[model samples]
Target: MRSSGVRSASALPCKVPYRIDIADPPDDALDLLIELGALDIEQLAGGLAAILPDSVQPEAVALALRSASITVSPAQGRDNDSVWLLRTAPLRAGGILVVPPGVDAPEGSLRLADSEAFGTGHHPTTALCLEVLAEIIAEDHPSSVLDVGTGSGILALAALLLGVDKATGIDIEPAALEAAAANARLNHLGRRLRLILGGPEAVEGAWPLVVANVLTAPLIEMAPMLVRRLGHRGRLILSGISTTLEAEVRQAYRHVGVNCTASQTRDGWIVLLGQASW
Candidate 1:
């Protein structure tokens, strides 16, 4: 396990309790906890923890309490497991991410949220997509965007926030769709963001920008359908692949004439950008 620095307000206290409030916790806050290096988590009256790192300062703890309305605080240790604490941070790319205290969203413009279907913007795959999305939108605003495997609907919502006229988010998981819808509402994007509970097979019509952030196998399988759904001069972004798997995904798209020579890698994940061959 990696060690994190710990800080606190006062000197040498044997024990202390801190509170972190998350009015609306995201669906995958628990998972985020683990990803952010919370060694342990528990739901007592209310709060969460990890083993305390020596670098923590009490003043920092107090500051967190003041700023957070939805708080997660440190509690008593149990069974030889110390419970250090964590809280949520606001994500800038179109929505707020509310995870338990100590869990942080990924760096960059991507925000964090609790979602079981993944793609909450904390994942490397999602971060790469956000950066690429910004570049693509900067060149020219896309009128419509289709985000397949929409996960928490972060991609579609981000597009809508970045001036896409309308966005369609598709996911096969009902829970994912529900989470996406909730996130849309949180960002006040309910009107512009449409959440569809299905796969690429259910998507109809062409879009100027289509993004699919899913695993290698599924991406390859859906390449044909995704290619068929892009308009002339439209762009497609594929993510959720590791650098090791990039060649496979690129070759799959190449077979359908959607060449993905342009790609980005972050934290071992790859995002491929391509355009439909006319």
Candidate 2:
């Protein structure tokens, strides 16, 4: 899972009726809009822009925002699918390289078709998680792993490519599950990757390693469930959190019998590493 305070999903197709741009909002405000039901959000040059949910009107979005230098306008629909798909240069994270589907991928490279869902591997939070996973994979040599809120299935797929035998990716969104399946097929790891729709409760058993790169709030909310899903000595990687709230998230997990033994930060985002004791 990426930050709910994402810049926006303009990289993917947008059908939402109205576009709302808020100039230089407080960091938490964009996420509040998402919680209030914004869609296809794109981080604007200076602020943030998001399309109102189908049932939500621009006025409602503005009213909810309560005057934060907002501009509501009609969205200019896209004609070609290729134009909206996110196309970027190869991204390197630890031992992995994220490239567009057709581009050449050297060993340890991932051919990702960036879409509406998160986990493009470009976000600092995602990259930081991957980096930590690479190190953990090297040190622990786990055979299987679980990914919570697996967006593009990047984390799970990367684990398989790095030598994990099987991976289970769970998310609440059907669209995200679809994207993850497509990516698993794209990587030819379909046999090893399992995609499930819903949260961690939907899963049947604990895992040797679990990687969840979602935002701070969900991370905290899911702390107990995440802790319960870990094997006696399993490792946990939590990302997609702002640095400011790291303490809060760490405390949440700590209360559930987990402790942050290590952490990594990049560009105002963070990933916490912990182990389960109970």
Clashes of each: 29, 5
Instruction: After superposing candidate 2 on the true structure, give the runs of residues whose Cα lies further than 4 Å from its correct spot.
Output: 1-86
Task: Kindly give the stretch of ten consecutive residues in candidate 2 with the minimal lDDT sum.
Answer: 78-87
C-alpha lDDT (0 to 100) for residue 142 of candidate 2: 92
Put down candidate 2 lDDT per residue, 1-278, tens digits, no spaces: 22122233244234545566787666676787878866467676888776665477555665556553666665543211211211345778878888988897686678777676788776788889899999999999998999998988989999998889999999999989999999988888899998999998998888989999887999999988888889978999999889999899989999999998799888898899998886
List, residue by residue over 131-212, the lDDT tens digit for candidate 1: 8987898786889999998877878877876778899999888988887887777666789988877887787899999999
Model 2 compared with the native: what TM-score?
Answer: 0.70
- Could you say which candidate leads in TM-score? 2
- Best-fitting candidate, scored by lDDT: 2
